[model samples]
Target chain A: MTRTSAIFRRELSGYFTTPLAYVFIVIFLVLAGVLAFFVGNFFDRGQADLQSFFVFHPWLYLVLIPALSMRLWAEERKSGTIELFLTLPIRLSEAVIGKFLAAWCFAGIALLLTFPFWITVNVLGDPDNGMILAGYLASWLMAGAVLAIGAAVSAGTKNQVIAFVVTAALVFVLAVAGTPTVLGLLQGWAPSSVIRAVAGASLFGHFTAITRGVVDLRDLVYFLSIMVAFLAANAIIIDLKKAD
Target chain B: MLEIRNLVKKFGPLTAVDDVSFSVPEGEVLGFLGPNGAGKSTTMKMITGFLAPTSGTAVICGHDIEAEPLAAKRRIGYLPEGAPAYPDMTAAEFLDFIAHIRGFHGIEARRRIAYIAELIHVGDVLHQPIETLSKGYRRRVGVAQALLHDPAVLILDEPTDGLDPNQKYEMRGIIRDLSPHKAIVISTHLLEEVEAVCSRAIIIAHGRVLADGTPAELAARSRYHNAVRLDLASDEAAGIAAELQKLPGVASVEAAADSGQATLWVFPQGGQPISDAIVRLARTQGWPVTGLYVERGHLDDVFRTITAPDATGNALRDAA
Candidate 1:
């Protein structure tokens, strides 16, 4: 556990040690705000709730989270620091979790910086703060899942750009799995059970369910399971690819 | 103590490290010598648990590397090839991170960082990011990181690779001072390093152990062992060469072209001392011997002889 925290502390401070952290946060904040106010019609929606704000999160994270997680393992391998890191007296799982948590926490910090949108909705009218809180939690959880997938993909290659592109493509499919466009295409030829299963597995579906004010146990489990599954794969990928 | 037994590592169809094995007792410095791509780095990586071997095992402080990697790794302080470290971190922060990971914290960790920084002379660059530091400083920082934990076993791969002469001397002094308490395995292609610091030497070639013994012992295996060279002012170059070759116990003699003097090298038949006999002969012939010295043999000659592809038949077994 101490070793895990040691790695965690290094990775967390690693973000702030460079301008990459500030640049990523600024881009995330600007894009999320712009997409919500200008494109999602947050002010024009007039709904006192942050549905318009939360609606753009999956799309925002589709690009931002990969950028955030691209260096989790890829940079280490590229720089040859993975040799030093793995030779330490720490388990592979601890290092993987520590780095994943650091990236996830960085994403969480970016999400928290969107507090102004929450304040904007609250000051304008009576809004159900419970649903807003749920929206934030769901968004952070979804970001964790995306970052986990990105971390796994990052371990697959030493090139961060490749990690980013592969993760973005994978996350995009997960994000649109439950949308009408995808379901419609599958409806004509696929079985109903297959369609239902695909929708249930979508990140968008689980996140949207929480934003609707009632957090289902299944949705919470789904997000946690995704994080765990991908993080585990991240550890395995690092072990297998470490020699390369 | 560290024991590597029959360690083998194969990367697909290529064997990077063949069944190489050796043991380092406490307070011994074993110099791992080999040519480029000769598996010195690969062997160290497997022992340090950075790479899994295709077969065999390394035991550190009685802990198996593969079965109990954490325990084995805890006993080792490894400086990987190229001395890689997090470039974004400052020297102080990097050492602090290493100390923390090694289970040191607070005042103890701070003291350790300070001690190692001073020991390796990296105090000047403590606050500078590793990337901005010079190559020598970066290498020192890597050394400090490895020594911060002060593990029982020290595996340094080319510790003085990028350092200047002064820094290399200091690094060697530090390693010499620390050798009495730790089992150190330093890998280098530098033959002089083996003589300067290592108490024992292992010569590897083609992913196999070509020879292992003390520096003097390996040097003794050269054909030039106990040979003598003489430079005389006399103009009888061929006559002296013929006389030296005819002398008993003298295997062969070669004379250099005359440049106002004759230079001759007399090789011994069985590692015998021929310098005294040559001195007697020079006195009897009234030839003025301007220069004379017996050769202890050269490690470079032995290294080339054993590592050369066609010289496999002449590879000497370990003298130990």
Candidate 2:
């Protein structure tokens, strides 16, 4: 536990030592506000809840989370710090989990900065604070899943560009998997059970379902499993390519 | 102590480290000598538990690297090739983080970092970003981090690769100062460094150990060992060459005149000492001698002869 925390503290502080964290947070806030008030039509909807504000989180995370995560392992490999890091007296699992937690916490910090939006809605009308709290949980969980996928993809290569592009593409497929158009395309060829599983397993499907003022245990499990499964793959990929 | 047993690493069909084995006890510094891609770094990686070996294990102190990696790693301090560190971190921050990883925290971590900084002479730049520091400072920071934990064993891969002459001298001084308490294995491209700091030298090529001995012992393997070179005031290249060739224990004598001055080389038969014999012959013949000395075999010659690409059949085998 102490070893994990040591890696965790170093990784977390590493984010703030560069401009990357600030740039990401600024972009996230600007895009979230623009999409919420301008494209999302928050006032026009006449709702006290932050439904419109929470609705665009999946779209926002699809682009931004990978940016935050591409450097998790790829930069370490390119700079050769991974050798010094892995040789320390720590387990591979601890390093993987510690890095993931750091990125996840960073995303959480950015999400917390969007608190003024919550206050805006509360001042505009009497909002259901419980539902808004659920929205925050759902948004943070979805971001965690995206960051986890990015972490695994970043470990496969030393090139951050490849990690960025591949992670964006993979998350894009997951975000649109449950849409009517995609399910319609899959109807003709894939088996019915497989198509149903794909639809149920879609990131957007689980994500959108939870942002509607309720957090389901199944949806929480889905997000946690994605994080766990991908983080496991991240550790395995690092161990596999350690020689390179 | 560090004991490696038949470590082998194979990437598909290509063998990178082929059954390499050696041991280093406390108070000994072993110099690992090899060319590029000679499996020197690869073997160090396996020993430090950074890369899993294809078919062997390293025992550090008493812990096996594969079975009890954390315990073994806790007892080891490794400076990987190029001395990689976080570019964004200040030297102090990196050391503090390393101290944390080594199970030191709070006051203890701070104390260790300060001590290491002073010992390695990095106290001046401890607060500067590692990227902004000079190459020598960066390399010293690497060594400092490896020494922060004060492990029982240290594995440094090319610790002084690009340092200036003074920095290289200081780096070797640091290695020698720490040699009495810990087992050290360092690999370098500079052969002279073997004589400078290493108590024992291991020459490896083609992923195998070609020779292992003290610096002098490896130098003795050269054909020039115990040979004598004589300088004559006379420019006659032929007369002295024939006369010196007949001396007992003298294998052959060759004389050459360069710019009107004659130089004679007497190679001893079967690695015998022939300087005394040549001195007596010079006195009896009344040859006008200016300078003469016995040649301790050149390490470069021994290195070249052993690792030559077209070596004879038996020379290709591991001599260690």
Candidate 3:
């Protein structure tokens, strides 16, 4: 465990030592802020809630989370640093978990930086801080799920571009799979149960439940399960893929 | 101390290492000699517990690599080939990370980092990113990282691969200094490197141990042991060659003429001493012999003769 923490510190330091962490925070804040004001119509909606802001999270994470995670394992493998990590006395699982946690924490920090919006809502109107907290929790969990998937894809190949593309595509499908916009277009072609199942699997549905202060255990379980499943797959792929 | 018993590694149908076994007594230096692709790196990897072998076992300082990898790894320092490292991190940061994982804390880690930097002569570039350092410095950092934990068994794969002559000499001196209390195995294709640093040499060709003995012992086994070289004056060259070739036990002789001087490379058969026969034959013919010396066959010849027949010889040799 101490070794894992050591690795975590170094991994986080790696993120910050480069321009990556700052670039990510700036881009994430700018994009989230712009969408909240414009497409989300926070002012026009005239609601005390941050429903306008939380609503765009599923779509925002589909692209951005993959970009954040595409370099995790793929870059390590490409640069031959995986050999150094694997040769250490630490267990493979420990290293994987440590690195995953570092990426998650970095993503979470970016998410936390958005709290000024929460403070702004509270200052201007009587917003439900409890619901806003729930929304933040749900959105963070969704990001974790996306990160896991992206990491797994990144482990499958040495090319970060390919990992990013595949992760974006996977997250996009998961986000829109349960949405009415897509179901309405294919309403007559597919059964309602199939549509509902697909829509229910969407990240939006799970996060929406949490945003409404409805902390369904099933939604939480689904997100946790996806994160574990992808990470497990990532480990398996890294073990199987021989270095060139 | 390290012991490997019949260690074998296979990748599907390709056997990278086979039935390789040897033991390194504490404080002994062993040279791992093989051609490119000869399982030197694979054997090192298995010893470090980076790869599991298909058969046999590697016991590092009494700990089995497979069963107790952490314990075994903790006692063994491995310098992998090509010196792989995180490009984004400075040498100091990489060393610090390694020190942290090796259980060095705070002030102790700082002291150890400084010690390693000075030892490997990378102190000047500690703050430079590893990618920005020159190849020689990068390799030094790799060696520094391997030695940071001060393990008992040091497995250095091509430790002097990219070093300049001066750096190579310095590295050789360091290896010699470290050999008194630590067991060291140096894997390299350069025969002179083995001659310079290793007390004993293990030659592997085609994934199998071809020869194992002291450098002098192996050199003495060459078929050219009885051969001699003689330099002759131009007027006496033809007479010497003709006479030497006809002498009893003299099977084949090669003579070359250059710049008014003649040189003869003589091969005497039947285990006969070339000098004894040549002295007798030269005196009889009254040929002036400017120089006469026994010509010891080079280690390179022995290596090429043993490893060239099977290119696969380069891929499956193991050193304990």
Candidate 4:
């Protein structure tokens, strides 16, 4: 709807109007490159694929997505623009979805800026471009899921730093829940259904599953469901807290 | 064009807006008056659909705020307290966004943005970031955004809060210009503002309506209504007060010496016209009267007399 686009345009431009967009993009590119080439040992593997570039996306997103989405709602509340925004002739869902789409689009832009990684692999050897493209798709999906979590947490507080820290902590727990160490701790006593539920909620688990060339419907469903569920909660949280 | 019916808002155990209700027809400018924490802003929020009421609802142009918030909101323009706006956005950008959400786009949006900018005197600062603009300009931008669509109902909370005298006067001029076609509700701590623009005034405290009437009607409730103030050059404060008290319609007289001159305030019985009788007495007695005038009462006194000092009175009412 036109109303939603209006909010989307304002929120997206809000990033560029300040140093937030440039600084965030700069940090995102530098960190993603360092993690992929230096820490991730992209050349050391030399398997004619971007396995190194794709492996660190979960860790990359855990920190970067929160930063991108922190000010989406928190700054609005702090600056008192949220009241003006909500009182406009639009539904609460429109504002929520519009702001989320802006933050997600910014994340997509930052992810797209990493195309040199893809280009480097293609020119260096006969890499499976199909697998690399799949990796990018998986990363974008996981980033959307992460940004959704950040948006929900951002709605509950007016402090952007608090939103960032709390979102980081919450997503960190979700990403680590399906690790062998955590599952080992839950085994022998916890029910298998509970363990499966915990594993299904692990963002890194679903993220890693989709990076191996073929996109799975279950993985797509998982990411989309997280987006829908978290965004719905974001709307409700903003409604309860907008009056604050 | 606007009506509120028994609107109540309670925050946990404390009630922020009690059973308060009022309506404003087209062409009427209602001045909402109350001290700090008097539920004026809370009521405005409910009417604007920013906060949901615990009990009642507001109807804007026949659209119930709770039943069809989008419809009601479309018909209302609200300038909240402090005139909050996006700090990072330029004034032009902010208004353009508002115009877009108000359903105008492209050339129509640009045309409206220009017109509202001119009407609000924010033309020069249209490209400046709102945060960088002066307080007066920022407040005008707030008013400009609210006036973008020219809704039937306008709710402005302290529209001229931080402006200078000239800006405040201009702001009042704008309100006077717009009131002929719209219903307006303005909340202020300035009694002079009420006298200048408001057709009717409502005083509230502890989330309850204390008094509602025309500005003159509320002022006439003051005890000083129809009273006379006399400034005499002579220093006989006591003797003249006694003589003035003996006038046929005079209820009581009190005189005080200021800078070696005596000033007397003569109250009339039942607010009768005692000025003629006092003049006759002063002339017959050949008193050294330098200045004399009858008082039409004052809004400040009426407001003070009607509102209690604390929440105890409201709490008592709540208990019953």
Candidate 5:
């Protein structure tokens, strides 16, 4: 546990020491705001909640999460510091969890910085603060799931660009898996069970369910299972590919 | 207290390290010598638990590297090839991180970092990021990181590779100072380094151990061991060469190309000292010998002879 904290501290501080973290946070905030008010038609809908703001989170994280995770393992491998890291007394799982948590915390910090949107809805009229809080929690969880997938993909190669591109493509597929466009296409030929399963597996579906002010146990389980499954995959991939 | 037993590492059809085995007791500095791509780094990686050996194990302080890697790794301070470190980190921060991972914390970590920085003479560059430092400073920081925890075993791969002569001397001094309590293994291609700091030496080639002995013992394997070389003013090279060969216990005499002065090298049949006999012969023949010396043998010659492509037969012949 001490070793994990040491790695976590080092990795967390690593983000703040560079301009990348500030740039990523600013871009995430500006893009989320613009997408919610302009593209999301928040005032036009006359909504008293932050549904518009929370709705853009999956898209916002698609670009930003990959940027955060591309360096987790790829940069370590590229700089040859992975040699020093792995030879330390820490276990493979500890290093994996430590790094993943650091990235997750950074994402959470960026998500929390968008609180003004929630405040705006509260000031305009009586809004469901409970739903807004659930939206924030679900947003953070979904971001963790995306970042976990990014972490696993990052371990497969030493090129940050490749990690980023591959992760973005993968998250895009997961985000669109349950949408009408994808389900409609699958409904034409696939079995009903296959389409339902695909719809159930969609990140967009679980995220939307939580944003509706109803946090189901199954929805929570979906996000948690994604994080756990991908994080475990990340550890396995790192162990198998570390020596290469 | 390190034992490496028949460690073999094969990557596909290429065997990077093959049946290489050696041990280092406390207070001994073992110099690992080999030509490039001869598996020196590969062996070190396997022993450090950075890479899994295809079929063998290394025991460090009673822990098997393959079975109990974390325990084994805790007792070892390894400097991998190229002295890899986080480029963006300052030397102080980097060392602190290493100290923490090695189980030091708070004031204890700070004290150890200070001690190691001063010991390795990296105090001046402690605040500079490793990427901004010169190659020598970066190398020193890498060394300091390895020594931060003061493990019982030190496995350094080319520690003095990029250092200048003075820094190399200081590094050797540090290794020597710490050698009494720790088992040290340093891999280097620098032949003189083995003689300078190593208490024992192992020469590997083609992923196999070719020779293991003290510096003097390995140097004695040279064909020129105990040979005599004479620089005389006389120019009758062929006549003198024949006479030198006829001397008792003399193996062969090779004369240098005819210059204004004559130079002849006389090998002994059994590495016997024939300098006095040659001096007497020079006096009787009225030949003025300008210079005379007995060879202690050259390590460069021995290294080349032992690692050459046809070295197996030549090595056996030389041994005979």
Candidate 6:
């Protein structure tokens, strides 16, 4: 565990030493702001809630999370330093968890910097602060889920570009598979319960339920399970690569 | 102490290492000699527990490399083939990371890092990012990293692969200084490097151990009994070859046409000194012997003789 912390500190500092963390924060905040205020029509909707902002998060993360995680393991393998890291006394699972936590924390910071939106809603009207807090929690957890998936894909290869493309495609499919538009198209062929189950499995479905000021244990469990599944797969891939 | 027994590594259908076995006793430097693509790096990786061998075992400090990897790795320090280091971290930071993981703390870790930095002569570049340093300096950092935790065995693969001549010499001196306390294996193609630091040399080819002995012994094992090349100014080179062959212990003679030099392959027949016999023959013939020196055989000749196209080339060359 001490070795894990050492690797975690090094990886976290590495993010700040380069322009990656800064660039990711700026892009995330700007894109979130633009999508919320301009396209989502925060004022035109005249809503006292953050429904407009939360609606666009799935699409935003589908593109942004892969960009943030594409280099995590790919760059290490490309530079031939993965062997050094793996040969250390630390277990592979600890290293994977430490690196994932670093990226997740960096992403959390970017998400938190959107606090101005909370303040803006307060200034304009009386929005439900409780629901807003819930939205932030959901967003943070969803970001972790996306980051974990991206990290697992990243560990599969040495090419960052391919990692980004594959992870983006994967997250995009998972994000939209159970959306209303896709479910509506399948309504005629599938039963309502089947459609509901499919939509229930989508990232947006679970996140939307949480952002509505409801802390569902099932929703939290779902995201946590997905995060663990992907991270475990990542550990397996790293072990296989070392074996090779 | 380390022992590699019947080590074999295969990638699909291609065998990288083939039935290799050797043992490194405590406090002995074994120079691993081979040409490129000779599976030296692969062998080192297996011994360090980084790669698993297909069907063999390596015991390091009484720990099986495959079964007890962490324990085996704790006892071994490895400098990989190209000496790779994380380019983003400073030397001090990298060493600190290694120290922290090796379970050193606070003042102890600091003292160890300082000692290694000064030992490898990389103190000047301690604060700089590893990628910013010169190649020789980076090589020193690689060596420093291997020396950080003070492991019992050190496996250095081409330790001086990319250093300049002066740096190579200095690095050799550092290795020699460390040789008395640690069991070290320095893998390289440079014969002189073996002569400079290691007392024993193992010549490997096609992923198999070809020959193993002390440098002098290996060289002497391939030496012909008084076979000497003479560069003498003589109008009749063939006549000299014929006359020298008639002397005791002179089994055969071969003459080169271009240099007018002849090599007499002697057999130490009847316990006669081949040099005294050649000297008496040369004085009688009035052949001005320009150069006459006993050949101190080299590793190059042994390597070529063992790995050449025909195994009998060495025997035939010795006979004539």
In terms of lDDT, which candidate is strongest? 2
Model 1 ranges with Cα > 4 A deviation: B256-262, B311-320
True contacts kept of each: 0.92, 0.96, 0.56, 0.83, 0.77, 0.54
- In model 1 chain B, the worst 10-residue window by lDDT is B311-320
Query: Is 3 or 6 the stronger prediction by lDDT?
Result: 3
DockQ of each: 0.88, 0.91, 0.66, 0.86, 0.79, 0.62
Clashes of 2: 0
TM-score of chain A for the candidates in order shown:
0.97, 0.98, 0.93, 0.98, 0.97, 0.93
Per-residue error (Å), model 3, residue B275: 3.3
Q: What tens-digit string does per-residue lDDT give for candidate 2 at B174-288?
A: 9999999999999997988999999999988888888899999988877789988788887665788888888889898877667667888889998989898789888998898
Ranked by TM-score from best down, the candidates are 2, 4, 1, 5, 3, 6
Runs in model 5 deviating more than 4 A are B233-238, B256-262, B311-320
Output DockQ, candidate 6: 0.62
Residue lDDT tens for model 3, B63-93: 9998998999899888888888888899999
lDDT of 5 by residue, A91-136 (tens): 9999999999999999999999998888788888889899999999
Show the colliding residue pairs in model 2. none
Highest-DockQ candidate? 2
lDDT of each: 0.91, 0.91, 0.86, 0.91, 0.90, 0.84
For residue B186, model 6's alpha carbon misses the true position, in angstroms, by 2.1
Which interface RMSD does candidate 2 score?
Answer: 0.7
Clashes by residue pair, model 5: none
How do all models score by TM-score?
0.97, 0.98, 0.92, 0.97, 0.95, 0.91
Model 6 / residue B173 / CA error / Å: 1.4
Off by over 4 Å in 2: B256-260, B313-320
Residue pairs with backbone overlap in model 1: none
Q: Write the per-residue lDDT of candidate 4 for residues B1-320, one digit (tens) a residue.
A: 99999999999999999999899999999999999999999999999999999999999999999999999999999998889999999999999999999999999999999999889999999999999999999999999999999899999999999999999999999999999999999999899999999999999988989888999988887779999999999777688888877778888887766887888999888888888988888899899999999999988987776677757545533532
